[model samples]
Target: MIFILIVTLLIYAGLVFYVAWSGYRGIGIKGNRWFLIAYSIIMLFLSVSFILARFGSGSTLLAVIGNYWLALFSLSLMILPLVHLIMLILRLTSLHREKTRVAAARIAFVVLVAALAYGSYMAYTPKVNTYTIDIDKSYPEDLNVVMFSDTHFGYLSGKKHAERLVKEVNELEPDLIIIPGDIIDDDLEIVEKKQIFNILGGLEARLGVYGSLGNHDKFRGELSELITAIETANIEILYDETVTIEGGLALIGRKDYSEGERLATEQLTSQLDQSLPIILLDHQPYEYDEAEQAGVDLVVSGHTHRGQVMPGNLITNRLFENDWGYLKKGQLHTIVSSGYGFWGPPIRIGTQSEIVQIHINFNN
Candidate 1:
């Protein structure tokens, strides 16, 4: 964890510095003293935000402010390199360069603002993606399963968001609902302040709404309360356990990797009737072979958030075999959600926030 923080700080700090230097050089020519003062103030704000947000007393509001600031700043960094490239070329060619640099800077700012605006809207507009899969099994009915992960009902969203989600899910009239984790981002204070738990209690599922833990749910060392809160909302935490739903299929929910894995996939599935179809709810895509070998029919997971933001999605795709969608290998199938909510930045660039609707049919 510390290593990750260190790396993030280092990288963000480097980007901040690069932005500062570029601004001083390019935009400074417009005005000297006022530009320097404004530049220093913005840098100070960003620096203070990073320091207090990470090392201070963990305020949700501060965290929220820091998140959007960092997000906008991060996206701005993407365009900075292009501006730098253009400036470099102008320097080399040395012909009408000042006007060109100013023009490039103006265009980049407009592009940055436009991108951020679009990303902001996309972040909140959660969409439902549908999938139809036929599992080879003899059963009496078709199972409509609604699965979503990373609701993250804390800072970016609140009780209204919870209510909206329940309404959306209930409208689908699902037999079962599965969540793969990250129901809340961090800090129970925000959860309590927003009454997110009570709002979430509104969720209704015929078979029951089942879920597993995610890293952020345990991030602030508040797993116990989060669990209590979830149970209070009538959402069952599966936590390395299995429950047979509607008398036909086994639903296995695994512990988040943050928590130690208590049982192997085989052990979890070993006691179940082999003839029945088995589905797994794991917060992350872990031990695929173990689940597949154990005769698990489908493994549902989220946590990659389909990279949540761009370029990051590229990294996520490389990290997981099925990072953002459905994949089938032999008899085992996997479905990963991009998630229904945003973390940190509350922005989705070149990615989406989504819920999965799976219509599963059994041959019998």
Candidate 2:
């Protein structure tokens, strides 16, 4: 973990320095010492603020600023590259280098700001994505399963966010609610102090709200405290357990992959009645073949966040077989949500926060 953090920091520092150099060149470095100094100070401050946040510095404002800056930095990484390419083409064509460079710099800055603003808006506005699937097994009626994952409820997602989510899910009138993981941010103090868990209790679902633990969900204080908090919210936390809902529909929730030595999917489903349809909830989207082999009708997950930012999804797409949407693998179906909240930065570029409402139609 320490090694990965160091490598990530190195890569981030390298990219930031490259972007800074490109910006300086784009603006034709002459008399730009002050600009360079200012930019350097801002980047340094943001970097330090982010590090402080990781170490529990406890300044919400600093953390928010740092995260927003991280989003802007990521946006710059994508937008500035194209600007540099344009500048290169203009320079090669001998089209007044100084003027082209300055224009490119101005355009890049404007584009970066616009992208950041748009992404921030996308992050806050939660969209409901509805998917209807036909189950090949017998059941009484259609099951309205509403799910949202990665609601890291701490500094970024506070009481208001929780309330909003509750209102939205209640409005959906779901028969069952499944939270695939990451109910809390890495800390439990803020969530408990603010009574965010109680606010989550407002969520009204007929079959009750159920959740599976994710990597982030396990990062905080006592596991018992987290479970108690979730239970207090009238939500059941399923840890490698199976429960048959009222209609004989079996719901299996697995411990997150980060939890170490979890029950195998096949082992979990070995003695289950397969004719009634089995739905499995696993936080991270991995090992699809195991779920398929285990006769899991549908698997829901959310750890990928579909990269949570632009080009990040491209990486996630390559990493997971089905990163964002629904995929049919033989007899099993999997749906991975982009998630309802942000992780590091409260920004969503090339992606939007979503609540997945799946309609399961059972054919007898």
Candidate 3:
């Protein structure tokens, strides 16, 4: 994992440098020393700002600038490549190379800005995605399960975001609310500083709020402390634990995959009555067949964020069987949320922040 991260950073740094140089040259401003210097400085700062923020710089200004710069940087990388391709195609025409470069550069800038604008709007707007599924098992009444993941409640998803989640979730009048994982961002202290827990405590659902520890949540604090904090907020944070809700169905929450060796799905469900419906919450979506074989009726997950941004989702789609949305294998139903909040940059392209609403209709 460390090696992969290092290689990814190197590749990212190289692409960023190439884009910075290409953009500067494309604008036909090579002769303006002052302009070049100013541009270089800004690019350099933006490039390293995220690293600074991640390393505990503890500056909101740096966090804002760095995170937003990441979004802009991603857009630039995507748009600049297409712009270059367009310019290359235009070389066949009568247009001069320099003029085409300048035109392409301007077009790229406009498109980048527009893409960022769209992505930012989508990121802030949380949508309720409803899914209705029929279960063969019999229950007294239908269950309205409202689930969302990856809130990352730090600088990006603070008070306002929590309030939005509570308000929207309550308005739905769900019987249950499930946060698969990633309730906190990277820092646990930020939750207290922002009074995010107080706001999240406002969440109203009949079954109450329940969540499992995500990979990000694992990094925030000690397992016991994090679980206590979440439970104190009226959320039940399960760790390799199973509970019988209303003595009707069983819900199992597993430790994250990064937690070394967690319990297997079949092992966790072995003791539970096979007749009762079973739901599992595993942060990262993996080993679907195991869940299905274990007689798990449903599984919820939220790690991928469905590529959170354009082209990023394209990669995630290939990595997981069901990166986002619902997938059923045999009798098991899996729903992977794209996430309610973002990671590095508070922006999402080709995807929107979502809360999943699964209306389970059991056979009478």
- Which candidate's TM-score is highest? 3
Residues 1-364 of candidate 2 have per-residue lDDT tens digits of: 9999999989988987887677667657677678779877876787677778768646778767767767877888888778877777777785887777788888888898888789888988899999999889988888899999999888887888888898998899999999999998887877888899889988888888899999988545678878887899898988999988888988899999987899999988985887779999999999899999888999999988889887799999999999998999988989999999989888898889999999998896
Rank order (by lDDT, best first)? 3, 2, 1
| Candidate 2: residue pairs that collide | none
**Deviation of model 1 at 188, angstroms:** 1.8
What TM-score, computed on C-alpha atoms, does each candidate reach?
Answer: 0.92, 0.91, 0.94
Tell me how far candidate 3 lies from the true structure as C-alpha RMSD in angstroms. 1.9
Compared with the true structure, what per-residue lDDT tens digits does model 1 show for residues 152-208?
Answer: 887677776788888999899988888989888766777878888887778778889
For model 2, what is the error of residue 282's alpha carbon versus the real structure, in angstroms, after optimal superposition? 0.3
lDDT of each: 0.82, 0.86, 0.88
Residue lDDT tens for model 3, 299-336? 99999999998788889999999999999898889999
Poorest 10 consecutive residues of model 2 by lDDT?
23-32
Which prediction has more favorable TM-score, 1 or 3?
3
For candidate 3, give the lDDT of residue 10: 94
TM match of model 1 to true structure = 0.92
